[model samples]
Target: MPVRGGDLHVGVWEPEGGGPAPPTVLAVHGITASHVGWAELARQLPGVRIVAPDLRGRGRSRDLPAPYGMPTHADDVAAVLDHLGAGPVVVVGHSMGGFVSLVLADRHPDTVSSLVLVDGGMPLLPPPGVAPDEMAGLVLGPAAERLQMTFPSRAAYRDFWREHPALGPGWTDLTTAYVDYDLVGAEPELRPATRVAALGEDIRELVDGDSVQHALDHLRRPATWLVAPRGLMDEVPPLYPDAARDLWTVRYPAVRMVPVEDVNHYTVIMLAEGAAQVRPHVVEALGEAR
Candidate 1:
């Protein structure tokens, strides 16, 4: 693992018997998640070169100072890609990662040849208030605020996760490894590497405004929106009601939505279950564009 720009650390899982030019796939994790979030997808895509970098303030990467908003993150990814040799590769971003990918498209369109938004890419419903502070917690979710934690014992963390048996089916040790990757403070009392303020900025960028809400229908690129049927929702709206009109249906015609069955916000892209179906679609997108 090597650090670039003194901010991001690149950790790659090289595919066996595969050389460097295997249609590179850059895997950007969600809000709190690091590169490990895409372990399942990396494992499935055996031949391709999997480039997974720890986003700023998350895994192996050093956290930026407070007020680290979306632009900073998008620039960070662009730097990582440039470090990987100024690529025109596929960008697959999950959760908050998708937001960054969209920003990358808007900011550095040439670098990113195709976009694969895992469970997130478009602008989600904002918090009613006009203030970014109000939407910070709601947008980031539990992971953002307390993004990382190193437990005294992995078993202790495992036990903590056992409280919710529902996830046991799809998620395995990767989820556990992801939480423990961010080690901060003294050994016994480790904390998440990122600051809450920085996490807030990430959320703030997402709900900030019309910056991300481009006319998706005519964006003119091989971009796909792959979401779990019932992904993370900040607001309480009907499943298919009039108010939901502002969702995927009304806008983003070019955006292909794969309503993955038996998946939710966290597990859709983070967990292993969605990989079988999701990976092919994304790989296909990369192929279509490449």
Candidate 2:
């Protein structure tokens, strides 16, 4: 789909026997991720159309220019729906994609009927005085570091993720495909496709952007936030910790919070077990949209 800066790359999955016009869901992957992140979710929800896009500066859309912020990403999503001639579909967003979903719902109110936010969308304050530009590298840690890494070969990159504590234990063909798709550049010099500068701009907004805050304050759409118990590295202190969850719950009572057990930030949408848990909520949201 052609949007603002360039032709956006979108991945669509048609349900097993879903003829023309099956219920459609617009999915958005996390920061540093591409449309392939939704592979498992697409498989799990075989009756609905799963449409995911590689946000500008990520995946194949890596060349899409700057001004990479939530509003820009939201507009790109709106353009995708317009290009498809689709109206108000349920939107599911994971990680930074969740933040984009919030702004989309708020900015393009008619574009999203409801939302399923997986491990993102709520506010996450930065450590006091941390520079906005540094937040991505600071918070993301390894996920951020890998963007600058060079792989000797595809297998080397696969090996890196295969050793990941969270993804390795549950590794599947889907993971392999995702890892493969993420690599760009020639062999022996392949690097992940996400642009570091784009990530920094987006992360700055996620950490303390006014758009997210305003979106939450006036959020009227039905939304569900699913949280992972572990962090990106499968560590205990997940992105949205218990206290943060509790505070957000009190602050935005309208957005329901659900806890997904034994999954890290990545696995919550990247693996079968996590997708199984997320399936019902997505179904419910789609059902209610009708």
Candidate 3:
């Protein structure tokens, strides 16, 4: 789809059987992920059209230049909706994509009828004075480090993820396809498609910028935040820890937070178990929109 900077590659999944147009849902991927991240969830919702874009610096859009941040991503999403004539659709975002969803709702409210934030969009403050690069390192950990390394083969890349603490146990065909789509080059020179510079800027904005805060402050639409029990590393205490979750609840009482058990940040929308929990919420949101 043609957006402001360039043509963004989008993955569109329509209902299996040909029928009257079903309700639309604009699904957004995480910081380092692409549209393929939504494949598992899309398979479960046969009654909806799921449109996901490989955000400007990830997947097929890796060649897109700099100036990446939440606001720019929001504009791109709105452009996608306009191009597809799918406005007022339910917007579902996972991880950093959740932050993008909130900004989209704030900047282009008419394009979004409701929001489902899957383990993101809420505030996450880094320790005071952490540099942007350092913050990226802290937040993304191995996910960031992998971008700097080159893999000898696609199998090697798969092996790398197979050992990932969060993703390893939940690996499936959908997850494999998602990971395979992230690789850009050929043997011995293969690297993840996510642009490091764009990722750094996005991470900085996620922690330091006031865009998310402002979006949360002025939210007038129905929004639900689903939190996983673990972090990206599959460690105890999720990204939205108790203290953080409590503060968010007090601050944004209107945004409901639901705890999803037995899943980490990655599996929240990347695997079948997690998608099952998320599907009903998405369905309810879509039904309510009518």
lDDT of 1 by residue, 91-193 (tens): 8888778877887777778777888887666666654564656665554455553445556654555565555433444547777776566556664666665
Q: Which stretches of candidate 3 lie over 4 Å from their true place?
A: 127-134
lDDT of 2: 0.91
| Candidate of highest lDDT | 2
**Per-residue CA lDDT of candidate 2, range 143-252, in tens?**
87899999999999999999988788889999999999999999889999999998878887887788888888889799999999998888887888888898899989
**Clashing residue pairs for model 1:** 57-63
Off by over 4 Å in 1: 1-5, 127-133, 139-141, 144-151, 164-169, 214-220, 231-246
Task: Choose 1 or 3, whichever is better by lDDT.
Answer: 3
Q: Estimate each model's TM-score.
A: 0.83, 0.96, 0.96
Candidate 1 accuracy as lDDT: 0.66
Q: What local lDDT does model 1 show for residue 215?
A: 25
Arrange candidates by lDDT, descending.
Answer: 2, 3, 1
Please say which candidate is ahead in lDDT: 1 or 2. 2
**Model 2: how large is the Cα RMSD against the reference?**
1.4
